[model samples]
Target: MKIVIFGGTGFVGLNLAEVLLARGHEVTLHDRSPLPPAAQRSLADYRERLKVVQGDITDAQGIDALMAQGCDAIVLGAAVTAGDDLERASPARVLEINVMAQIPILLAAIRHGVRRVINLSSASAYGAAGQRHRILDEETPCDPVSFYAISKFTSERSVARHAELFGGDFLSVRLSAVFGPWERPGSVRDTPSLQFQILAAFARGEPALLPAPGIKDWTYAPDVAEAVALLIEAERPRDRLYNISSGVAWSALQWGEAFAALHPGLECRLVSPGEKTVIKLHGGDRAPLSVRRMADEFGWRARRRAPCSGRS
Candidate 1:
């Protein structure tokens, strides 16, 4: 299969690209940024099957031209994950990138007769509903509170509406907090995963201090890549929307301790009662997402981090 991934230079994109490439699929990575040097090195073994194109996702003609070249499937992963400050400063840009930019790509897919389209969504779309429900599924009602959340939820709807009107095989997967290989600081996203922050602390020889336990069902990126690959290759998925996650909740501090175990001299612990913390957490603890649908549909479940379990 031939696949094109927009936002392909980003964290999730790179992971998905690697998965597709390893599985012997031809892949084209289209993004505004050039491929990172580290990722380039990691993917060197599959260089013959991988192609990287630099372009703006908002450019409709550019996308159409690429699709014209031929594409079997496309993954829409371009998004501006905004925080409070970015949302206040550039609200329109966030919506434009995260929401509006997807239309032309979907249209191009339809125009080129692409077989499948997957929009990479986020658990942030759950918003306040995440805290209210003990286990979120596709049917959970959302009350997105932030601009990023609203845009993601809106994007999912846009993809579904396009599919319905055009009779296209397009679906969106809402991924939980994803962290793993190929994660790096980038321009579009405001929040890096807690695992990334903890690793950064380890690199600096500083203790990882927690703002809070920061518990949630944080899925590994590689696992996420595999789940998405299943969707991209499946003959026909029954559902229009699905949630992809580890299916178990764990705290950031626990992850930090797990990392500390690997690093001899490092420390991972919570802050003093009133001490200040530099580490930024997305929000308070939320429930883990249920992966029963994914398991039932594709026999797919995220790899576990440890023995602890809940909500799988």
Candidate 2:
């Protein structure tokens, strides 16, 4: 399979690219950043097997040229992630990069006969999860709370509309808290509240700030990459949207304990913030998508291995 990945130079992109390459699939990575030194060294052997296109997604001409290379599928992994000051920034620029930029790329792919498209969506689109509603599934109502979530949700709708109009294949994977190796510096690899507290304590050798109590269903990067590969290879794709997550919930305290277990002798005072109730989504008793569905349709399974190091 010849797969083109937008923003393939980042954490998730690199992991997915590695998985596809190992399976003997031709891979093309489109990104504006120069290939990181680590990735360049790691993928050196397969330099010819992989193509890197340096251009912004806003550049329609460049995207058209990339699509002209005859990609079998395109994975839209590019996005402006959260933590930005959305209020001060221009909303038009935000939409241009996150929503409008996809138009030309998807159009070009369709024009060039691309078979399928996989869009990366965020679990945050379901809004803050709380005690009453623990799990958010594909059918759940979207209550996006942040600009990033809004952009991702809008992009998913746009992709679906394009698929409906063109009679093409598309799937949006609503991903939960994802973390593993190769994460970029200061990237949101951990839950935001947890990350801030952990970094302050561990990296800066300062006391930890307790996170407001909440449960998150975290997914490992490798597991997510494998699931994506299987979704691409599925003979008959069923759901247009699937939750890519571990399906197990862990509290912030549990995460902190896990981290402390990993690195003993790391003594730091802990400060607990008063408990605050937040919306909890997608951590219910039943699996959002049954194992049978994945097995019968896409041949995917939850990886039951131990959590990756540095995670709780």
Candidate 3:
């Protein structure tokens, strides 16, 4: 399969590109920024299977030229993925990148005779209303708390509407708390994984500390990438939105313990439960993502056997 991933240089995109390559799919990474040095070295082994197109996704002509290359599928992974930061920062830019920018891309996919197009939406689509449900399924109502959430939800709707109009094959997958390889720290996204922080500390020759521990669905990046690959290759999807997650709620301390055990010398310390932490677990609600539909429909499940990756 020839798959094109927009924002392919980003964390999730990079890992997805690798997973796709591993699965014998031809992967193309389209991004404005070139691959960072670390990603370049990490993906060096798969150079033959992967291709990078450095261009502006917001430009219509650029997108047309990209789609002209002919692809089996296209993954829209480009977006500003922060809730509070987007709310505080440029909210309009959030819609511009996440919502408005997707229209042309979707159209281009339709025009290119692409078989399938996957929009990488987020669990943020669940928003603050996600707090009410202990488990969020694809059917949950999205109460968008921030523009970022609104943009993701709106993009999903826009894609659905486009499919309705053009009869194009398109799907959106909602990913939750993804932490793993190729993920880097930047102004675009602020929430680093507990596993990521610990790993970074180990790299810096310091102990990893979990300030405040809580429970949330922390999905590994490679696993999530595999799930996306599964959907991209699916001939027909029963649902428009699917959750790609570990389908488990793990606490910071629990992760800290296992993480430390995995890396013998890496020490991880967890602070008191009441202290501030990376993921703010609201009232200790383990709002795990419901992957039953994905399993039942696609036979896709996240199998985590290695240490989760992330950046600081």
In model 1, where is the ten-residue run with the lowest total lDDT? 303-312
Each model's backbone clash number: 0, 12, 1
Q: Which sequence of candidate numbers ranks them by TM-score, best first?
A: 1, 3, 2
**After superposing candidate 3, which stretches have Cα over 4 Å from the reference?**
262-266, 272-286, 305-312
Worst 10 residues of 3 by lDDT: 277-286
Worst 10 residues of 2 by lDDT: 277-286
Which candidate would rank higher by lDDT, 1 or 3?
1
Task: Tell me which of candidates 2 and 3 scores higher on lDDT.
Answer: 3
Model 2: runs farther than 4 Å from truth?
A: 84-90, 128-132, 185-208, 268-296, 304-312
Q: Per-residue lDDT of 105-152 in model 2, one digit per residue for the tens?
A: 888978999988999887766664422364666666776655676888
- Candidate 1 per-residue C-alpha lDDT over 50-115 given as tens digits, one digit per residue, 9 for 90 to 100: 999999998899889999999899999988877887888899999999989999888889989999
**Model 2, residue 99: C-alpha shift (Å):** 1.2
Clashing pairs in 3: 180-309
> Whose lDDT is greatest here?
1
- Decide which is better by lDDT, 1 or 2: 1
The TM-score measured for candidate 3 stands at: 0.90
User: C-alpha displacement of 9 in model 2, angstroms?
Assistant: 0.9
